[model samples]
Target: MTANPLAPSWLAPPADANDLAASVWPANARRSAADELVFAGVPASVLTERFGTPLYVVDEADARARARGFREAFERECARIGTGVTVYYAAKAFLSSAVAEWMTGEGLSVDVCSAGEFAVALAAGVAPARMGFHGNNKSLVEIDTAVEHGIGAIVVDSPIEVERIASAAERHGRVQAVRLRVNSGVHAHTHDFLATAHEDQKFGISLTEAPGVVASIRSHSSLRFLGLHGHIGSQIFGADGFEESAARLLGLHHELLAGGAIPELNLGGGFGIAYTAADDPTPVDVLARQIADIVASECARLGIAVPRLAFEPGRVIIGPSTVTLYAVGTVKRVTVALPAAFETAPDDSTDPSAHAAAGHPEPATAVRTYVSVDGGMSDNARPALYGADYTVRMANRVSAAQPALVRVAGKHCESGDIVVHADYLPGDVEPGDTLAVAATGAYCWSLSSNYNYLGRPPIVAVKGGAARLIMRGESIDDLLARDPGIGSATRKASTAPAHAEPAPAQAAAQRAS
Candidate 1:
């Protein structure tokens, strides 16, 4: 089968549309003897039958292994340099009580950016001393809660946050540890919206301003200044950005150490993962060694001891460990005109008079199939939000049909509701077929919404041939229960399991009660 001109240059027609790339899928993902997609030893059909469509299936063992891999790799690398490392599971990627427990069990700390995330970590019984708090605009209440709970560190984003955290620590009669987030002025090679360390962003203070902020933090009697923190961006493919950012931050670290003890240096996590066949991210172990080398070289050059290193890796650990299973609802193949670059040149053999009479040849066109699924932006918003690309496969069963170029779309009302912008699926793909999108474990669930009134899908953890819900799917009653007008009755009559655990807010309120 020839490649379609409409397809992106990076997307090639696969030899077998049913084949799953090892780097883009969970370690345990495979095809069963019956040709059905099996994740963590459970068939996709069984999962959809039990949990319904648009379900998130996370490989428990895969996630744990990745977490352990990061911890061990960084530990070994940093140890070689006579220093230590802390791998914080960035909860903003996707957090559940189960996930928090998994990270803690793997000897990793948790990084929470909100009170709700903090509450979740606490509810999971994670030691507050191992958790770090982060937010550009944290409320006073949130700061107070972090201080009162004895958080390991609160990454101060703004100058005002220093005073807020200091006041909270004073009120709680505790000495709080804080890290000032600084902009290293390193522009990571990534999407503009994702690049954070650039000076124009809202994330951190300039390198120039960081000194004053650190001074203010040191002035506070109740605050312990840890060190500086910086995050370059997400989906980074190489180590150059980390190297550059570390060089800049290390320079600042050297100047600050002269004033007082600076024990830790946190380069926040934006590590990338393989979302599709086109993505080839650096291995965690290799990346760890590279970063360690960069930090060691910079510190040695500056004639300073290497500080304790910290990283918050969220996506690389979890992104490829899960897949979203969607039921195909519709399939429509439409002929689209190819761009001018793809158009064929006028034939020289044709006479000028004949060509003039016939006019220019009709624009080249190609067929693109739109495969609509039961879910959309509500379940996975990356495609619509970041214009993220993903690869899809026929999940319920495999076929020997030729590969067909497809655009997997969501059921949402918006035209931008896409799941996989471009991929090859079996030509026989049609309604009732179940499709799986790989590498959705990261921000998908955390950024999911009720757009078009679609309830969020449940996340199920699969391992050793068993499946269990880590989070329950939202039902219609769950959505209606939020309405003040007609929701009162719905809330009272809703038959959803009352045994389900409370959300962070509910948990906090329960503690108060």
Candidate 2:
């Protein structure tokens, strides 16, 4: 069958529906001896039986390898050019105590953007001095938390936030290291919402305002101005944006240094990763070389010494190392009428079925299949939030059936709850089969929710043919614990206890289960 005209331009039917794309999948993922998809030598069948459906499996070896690659590549490039560099794992992509520990063992720092993220880093035994706190808006309590813990640097997003951090630092009797985030007005080629340094976003201070903000930070004795930082956007593919951002930042760095010395400069991370065949991401070594060359060239042109450099990569490192496995629940076929003349849907009706039922005239009808899975946007909100595209493959077994264009949907009531908008699956795809969605390791779990009262799925890490749960699944009781209205039963106790109640040991155990 030919590619569907209604599908997005970037999507094309593969020669073989069963053939997995190597670019988007984890490094260790491949067809096993049993002809099934395996991650780190463990088959998807084994994972499904042991952990059940709607499971997230991380190839631990792949993740560590990527981390090592980034660190080594950056270090090598910086050393070749005689510049120092640090690689900070962006915690916003996905953070767990174990993951943080892995980063620590790999000799990488962390970039945290919230108090909770900082707490997670602390819980994982990561030194506070190795972490950089970032966010556009930092509440006084959060600023105090960072100051009290002696965080390495707090990336100030606004002039007002600079004052807030300074006040908190003074209150704690500590000198806070700070970096001012500047919008370079460079637009990266990506989704509009992910583009940060485009001058209009809520992320960083505009280039025009950054100089004044730096002076404000320098005015506060409690705040130590580290350097200037610029992040163009996330999921960036080309080095053009990085180079442009570096040049602009270096220009500002030259101006800022006339009075005082700047020790460090941060070119923020928005490195892109392959999510589907449409995406072709730059290799870590190549990206490092490109960035190093650009920074080195800028510094040479400006006749200034290279400052200590750092980058926070969250998606590129984590995105390809994980896959989400969900079980097919239902498959329904529907007839869609092709639009006449302009290929536009009627403004009066948004529902295809409703429009058809109304007996509207049409040129032709196209039959499409909807494969519904047990999980939806609650576990991975990227699809609903940003229309993020993902690739899907049947993981349990191999088949020779012809390709069938299908839309993989979630169990949620919302019509926008789609996982894979368009993908070619085997015609024999059916219920009880395991479907693996590749390149979901980045933001899916980090942005998951408990919507519709459904428990968040557990994350399983696979290494050396071994599988272990890194994070346990949430239970109904776990959700109930936060509800104050419900005590021992559905309702609160009628009488108050004279003594403090024993820690809900049984409830805790149930949640663990």
TM-score of each: 0.92, 0.89
Q: Write the per-residue lDDT of candidate 2 for residues 123-173, one digit (tens) a residue.
A: 999999999999988888988998999999999988889878988899999
Worst 10 residues of 2 by lDDT: 494-503
Deviation in Å, model 1, residue 178 alpha carbon: 0.6
Query: Which candidate number would show the highest TM-score if scored against the true structure?
Result: 1
> How well does candidate 1 score on lDDT at residue 481?
73
Q: What lDDT would each prediction earn against the true structure?
A: 0.86, 0.83
Compared with the true structure, the alpha-carbon lDDT of candidate 2 equals: 0.83
RMSD vs true structure, all candidates: 7.7, 7.4
Q: Where is model 1 more than 4 Å wrong at Cα?
A: 190-198, 344-361, 487-513
